[model samples]
Target: MTMFTRNDKGQDTASPATAQPVRSDAQPAASPVAETRRPQAQPISSSSAAHGTPSVSVISKALKITGQLESTEDIQIEGEIEGDVRAVSVMVGANAKVKGTVRGDQVQLAGQVEGKIEAKKVILTRTARMSGDVVHQDITIESGAFIDGHCRPEYGKAEVKAPGLKTVVAGS
Candidate 1:
C-alpha cells in the first residue's frame, strides 16, 4: 500500500509538459506598439523669447554686487556694483550706481558711475551722472548729462602711456 495518493480533483489539472510554448516572432511584432507608446523627450531651449540676441543677465534694483563681473554677453544693471564690470554690451539703468570701471563693446549709461568707462561706443543719457573719464571710439552725451572728467575718443588707438606706468616692449 502507498503512503500517499493524489486526490480525484487534483489529478484532473493540466501538467507542465502539456503547456504551450511562446513563439519568438510574437516579440518582434509587439515591439512597434511598445515604441509608439513611449513619448520622445526633447531638450529645453533658451529662456528669453527674443531672437538674434542671446540671454541677458539682469541685476535687479534691490541687489548689490561687491566684486568684478565679466561676461561674453550683454548685461543690464539696475542695482549697485562696487567693482568693475566687463561685457559685450552693458546698460546702466536709471538710479543705478557703479563705483568701478565699466568696459564693453557698447556702453549705455543713464545712472551714476564714479569710475571710468572704456568701450567702442558710449552713450550718456540726460539722467546720467558720470564722475570719471570716458574712453571710447565714439560717444554721445545728452545735454543734461553731468560729467566731471574728460571724454576721450582714443579707444582701440595707440595713445601715449602715462608716466610711472610699466610699458610692455613686445617681441623683446
Candidate 2:
C-alpha cells in the first residue's frame, strides 16, 4: 500500500511513485540490524492455545435466514433460519430458529437449530435448542440451550446432510 505523507510543516512529501529503493549488488542478504528493528512474534505456549478460540459477536432476534447463507465475514442471526448458512463466523440468534444445515468457519447457536452444522468454532448459547449434529474444531455451550443428535469436533463431508431435501441452491 502506498501512503500519502505530509511533513511537519504541512507540506506534501514527494509522490510515492518516485520513492523506490535502489537495487545494489553490494546488499547483503539478512542483516541482524534490520531484524532487531522489527517486532517479532513470540511462539504461543501450548497450554493457552489449547483452551479455545474467541467469538466476535452474538445474535439477538429479528433477522431471518430462510435459505443458504454464505459469506466470509462474521455474522450473527437474530431472527430465524429456514435453510443453510455458510460463512467464516456464524451465530444462531436467541430467538432465532434454524431448520437447515449451517456451514461456517465458526458457528454459535443461541436459539434453535434442527439441522447439521459445520464450522471451525461452534457455540450453543443459553436458551438455544438444537436437534441435529454439530461438526467443528471448537464448541461452547452455555446453560439453557437444548440440543439433540451428534456433536463432532471433526467430521467428513458425507456426514453433513441438510434437512428438507432441497435439490438446487438459490441464485444458481
lDDT of each: 0.75, 0.61
Which residue pairs come into collision in candidate 2? Answer: 61-78, 127-144
Write down the lDDT that model 1 would get.
0.75
Model 1 alpha-carbon miss at residue 11, Å? 41
Per candidate, the number of residue pairs that clash is 0, 2
Best by lDDT: 1
Residue range 13-116, candidate 2, lDDT tens digits: 22222222232112332232233223322345554444555333333475655666655456678777687766666777677787888877667777788888
TM-score of candidate 1 to 2 decimals: 0.62
The weakest ten consecutive residues by lDDT in model 1 span: 161-170
Candidate 2, after superposition: displacement of residue 125 in Å? 1.9
